[model samples]
Target: MKKTILGLWLLACLSLNALAENIYPISREMGSGTRSAFVDIFEIYKSVNNKKIDAIAQKIEITNSTGIMLTSVANSKNSIGYISLGALNNSIKPISINGVIPSVENITNKSYTIFRNFNVVTKLSNPLIEDFLAYTVSLEAKPIIQKAGYISVSKGNFKSKNPRGKLIIAGSSSVTPLMEKLKESYVKINPNADIEISQSDSTIGVNSVIEGIADIGMVSREVKESELKKGVKPQVLAIDGLAIIVNHQNPITNLTKEQVRKIFLGEITTWEQIQ
Candidate 1:
């Protein structure tokens, strides 16, 4: 215990000495719904000639997908990033924000404030697509979604009408994990239905549906009004907390909303500063 304390003290001192050098903050690339929701939730913007422009610090590392975000944090020291709580695993440590752990109960009860909608988009839905979508919003999918650490919001019963067809679902990597589980359960009951998912960013998911390439698009954030204008309908499947994660080696656990906002905005640029 003494040695561990001494080591941490020494490290903190080193971080203090270089207040703006080593700490790395990671975020998703632009056009990502997860990034959009994060910026909105945290109010990460600035007025430029009266227009509110996104003002994420230039130094923040950008990853393309939730998988990349997890891997980047796991491999890098003094790194911080965020991903869907449903996707969290043992590779990284998720820290509490404002003393509230990102859990299903907290998200469902509305205590954990950092959360976003898990939306599924569709354009000119076919009968097969509608049937599968019906299954997604029914009570049967509730346990599967909840089991994946997301807050299931649907309460309905679905009886598959023996629909048979092939369909594609593409979109936000953040929503893919839960969607995959839901797909597995749906396919078992409706054996004639075939579904393939292509993993990518949220923007691509919306566009793909608009272009008539995919029957369904999974997006981590709510479907934008701009997207709605394109004649696509969005179905919110569940609610998910955006889990702030760090390398497992990091010791500090909790951060205030203000602290996180500052860190990503380049105001708090070091581990010691956050400490």
Candidate 2:
């Protein structure tokens, strides 16, 4: 009789814990180009006395890279986050925005609007850098880009001059996978070329190029005006969207743009509120 009473009390506590589950909004740390693009597309900015400022909740979970974003959302049953569509995998579920599902065809046809450009920034020009950058945007790279789940937006040509030099690429984790594929092909053509990729957020990539620390910067968002002013030239490599992902346990599949905007803006605080 005492054992039965203890089991019932434990069950009651479990039920209460489930009932108290609330939505956890996860965001990337500052200086992430992905965060900038998501915030801009979702209109998460607020005008306070005519001065615009970011309005993401002050206490939300913040991650440093795309991989971490996926891990955080996948680990938490109530967490919601965003990542590059190309980097998306089976670990988490991507909820459709509005009625449009995120797919390569949908993104290509303009049905999926929450997308950003994958750019490579270069502050100085050289033979190896020029060849590598051209190869990334050329028609030859399309198959690799497509295979990696990103949309190709360029059809330029690449001819192997067999340029030999060491080059460093630093930037967005979203673009690193595609870049690695391209690096393999480029190195085969020019065996003497050594390519190194250091993955981080987009802002760091662009800044690394501008500061002369890296030869190429992988920026997932459009090149900023300030960065352009600083003389880092951008070349579009591919196009990708930010996928709204949640833990696989979350049953809610589709969210309207308004609901998403509100959630990110901190207006909607609980899972029950959205349901």
Highest TM-score model number: 1
Error of 1 at 59 (Å): 2.3
The sequence of per-residue lDDT tens digits that candidate 1 reaches over residues 178-256 is: 8889889999999999899999989999999999998898887778788999999999888889999998877668999
Residue 6, candidate 2: Cα error in Å is: 25
Evaluated at residue 177, the lDDT of candidate 2 is: 85
For candidate 2, write residues 111-159 as lDDT tens digits.
9998998888999999999888878788888888999999998676778
lDDT (C-alpha, whole model) for all candidates: 0.88, 0.88
| Model 1 local distance difference test score | 0.88
TM-scores for every predicted model: 0.92, 0.90
For model 1, what is the error of residue 238's alpha carbon versus the real structure, in angstroms, after optimal superposition?
A: 1.0
Residue 91 CA displacement from its true place in model 1, Å? 0.9
The runs of at least 3 residues in candidate 2 whose Cα sits more than 4 Å from the true structure, single-residue gaps closed, are 1-20, 48-51
